[model samples]
Target: MEFLNHFRNGLVEGEDRDCFEKFLSPHVSMLYKSAIRMCGNPNDAQDLVQETLFCALKSFHQINDPEKSKYWMFSILRNLFLKDIEKTKKRAEIEFDSVCDKLTDRKHPEGDFLRAEVKSNLQEVLGKLDERLKIALVQFYFEGLSYKEISESLNIPIGTVMSRIARAKVYLKRELLRSESMRLEISKYIGDEE
Candidate 1:
């Protein structure tokens, strides 16, 4: 039969099928967890996982270390998620620009006030970050690069990348806390006046 001929052709050999199932099946849960975290929605997470699995299947032969398959799968997932994020961001930017153009003709005082407050708070916190820390955070979080990729791109060691990201998180937390405390103090003062 044609099925026998296909099997004889080595397209779906038993060894390849066994290797694929062995390496990929055990990591399905972890992959789904990572996909959910990256996507923030179940449907999108499922799609991401499916896409990652498809790519992994097509290139499973390239995975040299079976022990490191989890990390390899993660790298693939992360890369796909980052590409999706980039495309989404680009679309969002275009839509936001058009919305902003339309909103410019309106006079929404409360909206303006809220936007200014949020912008100022963010700017203050970001401005307090060290230049290197800021760059690392931006590249890792916003640009969606892996620590290894960021290290290569920035010409820094992997250890340095890890440290910078860790330091950036600490600094951001401290700055945010300070900003919140200041805001609360101002709110208290205004309440006392009224």
Candidate 2:
């Protein structure tokens, strides 16, 4: 508790610290919940919330309306979350590309064939989707982010995220069905030739 107080004191001073504590401290739980939803993991959520509090402390003087402080903190959290998402995405893409390149350079015919088939199928399905739908589906399904989290991250309404996920699923099912049929037809043709 002593350490916490010392840390708090380091964050702000004078009347500003009093005002900041009165307005912002009450909403710590709400911010933690939001951080959890946005981060999708407890450790990351804790880190995010800590960073958000530090930032809020640094800029507490800029908040003019005490009633709007909640919204202001939310906006700050959202920005931090978005920036983290971008950094993660960039790092993942680079790592993914590097792994793909390494895997492609190795010559294992069966493994290569299986990977190619799966990759082609996924690419075909994803390629047919609109960019917005693709991103929405990836964030919700692949990343396991909740609808509210997706809405906050994408800066869209929750209803819009719902509709996009529905539409993307429909498109994926249709494309997969079509691909399956084509593959079956080709298999039959090759069997007949054999």
Candidate 3:
């Protein structure tokens, strides 16, 4: 606690980089452990700590309360961890949508074989739809594009995109029931709507 107070005081007094580094080194392991739990990955935890340290150094002058210094660092680490999760989620969604598009457009015999193996487990109703309907479904739900964007990209009216998405859901309901395992997986992905 006395160490923390001195570290806080140094930050408040605009301590030299070397002095700050001495103080920071002692707290590195503690901060890294906290960050690991927050981020759920070792690499991300290390990054979060580095970022938190950078932020703390940059805004050290604003921390007036030495006693609250620990909380301040934790707050910065938490926010960074959450932001990292959000970025990962967005990237995963984009990659999934890209893969879905490629899967839907594949024309090779091996592609068909692979699709047959895995796609059969989906609510087969999706498989039965025309390529256009499949594309519309994947674009709106899988890719999360707005109706306006979908319309412009598909070269169709916005109203058409809306109706197509709605109809796609109905078709999905009918087809997915054919395979219970696929139905459960699909439900996990789609959820109970937005």
Per-model TM-score versus the true fold: 0.51, 0.45, 0.36
Point to the candidate with the largest lDDT.
2
- Candidate with better TM-score, 1 vs 2: 1
Q: Rank the candidates by TM-score, best first.
A: 1, 2, 3
Instruction: Tell me the spans in candidate 2 whose CA falls farther than 4 Å from its real position.
Output: 1-13, 90-194
For model 2, give the 10-residue run with minimal summed lDDT. Answer: 90-99
lDDT of 1 by residue, 1-194 (tens): 23223323543757666765678667777667656544545677777777787787778889777777776776677678768866765210101222223323235555555444544555556655555576567557655679986775456799999999999877655564466543453443234332
How far does residue 154 in candidate 3 sit from its true spot (Å)?
Answer: 45
The parts of candidate 3 lying over 4 Å away from their true place are 1-19, 90-194
lDDT of 2 by residue, 43-111 (tens): 676777778877887798787777767767766776787688667652111012222333342355554
Better of 2 and 3 by TM-score: 2
What tens digits encode model 3's per-residue C-alpha lDDT throughout 1-194?
33334445545443646535654556666667555434435766676787887787778778766444555665566567557656765111111323333444366555555445335434234435554565566656654657875675555788998898888778766666456654544454466552
How far residue 104's Cα lies from its native spot in candidate 3, in Å, is 44
Candidate 3 TM-score versus the reference? 0.36
Cα deviation of 118, candidate 3, in Å:
28
Candidate 2: residue 193 lDDT (0-100): 31
lDDT of 1 at 40: 46
Quote the positional error of residue 130 for candidate 2 in Å: 12
